[model samples]
Target: MSLQHFSHQHPLVFIASHGHEIEKVNCSACGELVSGSSFGCVECGFYLHKQCVEAPAEMNHPFHRNHNLNLFTRNPYLAGTIICDFSRKTCENFVYHYSCNLDFHIKCALFSHSIAEKKNVEFQDISRIDPSINTGNVTEELKKAECFACRKPLLDSIYFSPNCGFYLHAKCVDLPAEINHLFHQEHPLFLQFNSQRLSCKICQKPQGPEFVYCCSPCKFALHIQCATIPTKINQPFHRKHPLILQSVDECLPCQICQETTNLNDFVYFCSICKFVLHIRCVSSPLIIEDKLHHEHSFTLFPRQVLYCDACGTLGNYVPYICSTCGIFVHKNCISVPRVIKFYRHQHRIPHTYFLDQNESEPWECRFCLEEVNTEHGSYFCSKCNYIVHVKCATKNSRWYYEVDSTETEEATDSDEPVDLREIHPHNLILSGDIRDFKQCHGCLLPIDTSYCYCSQCDFFLHKACAALRAKKHIWFHYCQKLLKLTSGCIFQCCMCKYFTSGFAYTCDKCKERFCLRCSLLSDMPKCEGHEHRLRRFTGESKELCRGCGTSVHAFICKPCNFNLDWNCITLPLKTQHSFDVHLLNSLITLMITIIQEVIIVIFVKRKGIPNIGFIIV
Candidate 1:
């Protein structure tokens, strides 16, 4: 469409407005009324959005590949709905377009429609339009137009759908809150910010506001990211199993949906169903019971008992309670109605119902170097007592397969699906606390999650974050503890190998902020050969340190031109460095060799190297 047809579309006429009345469908940028003729504003003037001119009667986007895109005639920014994107198996929401079933952000659609057609591009439906509106009389109730989001009046920036008598404040037409993005099922994603993540409930694609739904309650939840799946399912992936809408009351921790499920936020998922969960919700069973392996019934437990003759994981999976002697054994141990086909050994081990611990020689674990007591266990053959840990026996978690029964969408009152995605690796706890520093005590990520801080020495991390991946990481020699960073102490960054002057992970003893990863230099591959393992700083305290005077999130060690972003503390240890010359992580032994040469040379020379000083051998 081009501006050539606008001469016949609308004629300038006087409009009455006691305050502000609906005027001609116009391009606020240009005096010409927008009636679907022309490119942007009259060639020399800014034009009204194309979507504004030809308001859709109905629309279905390609991205929203599966849903029925219904065109709504009313404002959608009125309320919200709990959304679940069946694709990612997680959701994030708290806002919606309005009461209308418009799925796309109003602003997003406005812009998309406006730019969809290039300037002067001839459209097949081109024709001179009769664009005229009668602002004959203003009703006392209808005259008061207001924005539903910010609750402001229709000011300068506004969008009106003339075909349906709908209106919205331009600014309020699009708005989304920050979320972890727990509303998808297939693809992995996080917050897109204002980049426009609004999509459809059925098609798993981007859409406009006309194809959405909104709730009447708080108006905080949104339906754009929802799956619109009906409460029942029978798909190719799960024909025999039944899938239903998650009930809010049944908030059991999902084994497959949560990465930890340690907190109480678990909701609607099926143990029997083969549906997978979000990365944040992936978890395996710690305890279970079955009647197949053991002659008697047995329950699985997560604690260690006497060594088992078969799998030796210190009674960690789950143990079965005996009706007699009060003895507990792993279901995979003792009794055998048992004929099992071994994958690794490739030999069928016939059922041997021997539960006697008094056997002459107890079996030893083949994988782990550990002794096994024959009491509550299984033994292979006399010659080869190849032992597998009970935990390792069922590594696939279970012996079952099903079709991926994706649900046919229905209007559901479900909350955002559980966040089965990856954890915020940076949200770990800071263990070694000190003053004026704000960094993770353990991983050295950042101090965002609820954390512990030291008034004397600022350190922090939420209790749960501190415990994350703690088993794999122990403290380094330089820093006594990997305390969370807090306010009150000065810090020097461990990364960028610079002395941070502001808030960071600092040592109380040395009064310096050296990050946990940098302090663990010896534990790393290339850092082993350095003259000294990067321990907590041993520098003496001095007042007026530049790094100590800044805010909590930044780690500034000015003397060395070093600054650490407090968020770096939780970074993985095997991460590759910037100055290492290689794009990949250095092998442990090779890394150690490089460190040795660099630090040794620096130690002997008594001065920094020409260009390699920061390359801390």
Candidate 2:
């Protein structure tokens, strides 16, 4: 029958059936090899598949819901390159396009529509195909093969065809052709192969050459599992509000784990309560039964709390509580070690909830030289009366090590009398007597007790300072080279920035020096004035010290707006001033008070004191 189509100018003839002889001729509409039933114009050598010829001019495609896709005989883009969203193959002739720059081949659009409508008969139940029907070798070969769609091993149920060599996971075959995900709301994600091998935004894992839902323009991709996460979920801990999946750039803390979400791009957020949760923490257990941490199981306390009794840190929304002990704690703090040995102390310290206040003054933390709160948990040693804040003691793994409770406690190296003749040239005798005016040659700090005295040379070294190794690595130094212990030469300490002739750790390569006191400073220094740990200030701008009101390089607690200069940080707890008969308490406070009084006196004298001068009492 002679037929005339809008795509061609001349009349065409319909061929009911054609063999391989006519397969070489391409279809004018679909641009695929034309065979079987088709219409052809002999003079123009133009042909169209019967199905392609019958395709509608414009249709509502399931893949793109916002706009109707219109059939196009030529490339619609200025670049003249159109690739089908579904098949990911170049569409040379006929294509379906929407206003949003989405394109699809005629066959691909029809195939996806059939699949979405659940009318594709080619999708068969994988269980119906029995591997036993074939030989063991063929069954083994099939087992070793991976699904063509996801590129994952086909261990689970999959759609397979032996003749076509097509293998696809059942879930991959059912994936949506296009989806509007919360992670990339600017553009719709299309199911495509990971040809560029981009990393998944959700999991932060590199993607293999597998099927991934991707936004090509933004280069955003997500795995099938990550992309299919529910938009809203009702967690047991946060039963009042359903958390919605959102992409946020701001630094927010996760309610479940109480950790900053800066490293994560996507989080589950509750708009009503402003509660945020890490995607991985959505499945946190409601009850924890760790016997090593405690004898009783801890139940989830799903409410805002002021503080955690275990670590004494500010609490968040989701903390676990022990009903038996009446203690609320963070999930991560449940496994805090019972006993630990700090590098700064000689004796093993045990965790204690409360310290006895029988002493005249508040116990001080030896690590940071800050007053330790007797109420909160802390690491205490009964033998040495040494105490440290729980957060400070366990801040760095290199500074402390967990000790087995059952293991025998060995005498510390400081306790054993060491012959330092090799390094000091004098025989040093260990003494525990309080020397009134003796100073440690190693640290240059006054030796109160437990020091090695050399009466022959009038030199002394604190027991702890005497054990200083010849070479060591200071954690805070930018240059990681080992520092050598050197004496006799005066140099400015890189950490405290003070010039002293005392023993110092010198790095020849970096030309940096650190005094004995500053070399022992931990990475995170806890201050009594602030609840948070103090970090070394690295900004170029001047920061005023909270203690003395002077701008100097200092340790800063950013959250608390606290800055402490090196002089204030290393101030002795007790100092003997020539003006006072008794020992003065808190040298930092005393020095600042004296300085303020002197400033007031200088200002009065500068303004010219009146003739009626006060008489001395």
Top candidate on lDDT is 2
lDDT of each: 0.35, 0.71
Best by TM-score: 2
lDDT of 2 by residue, 124-188 (tens): 53333434453453567577877656666665554455443355556766777888887688998
Q: How do the predictions measure up, each by TM-score?
A: 0.22, 0.50
Worst 10 residues of 1 by lDDT: 86-95
Per-candidate Cα RMSD to the true structure, in Å, reads 25.8, 14.1
How big is the positional error of residue 357 in model 2, measured in Å on the Cα after superposition?
4.7
Model 2 misplaced regions, further than 4 Å: 1-174, 182-188, 199-208, 289-292, 302-304, 356-376, 384-386, 416-420, 423-617
What number of clashing residue pairs does each candidate have, in the order they appear? 133, 0
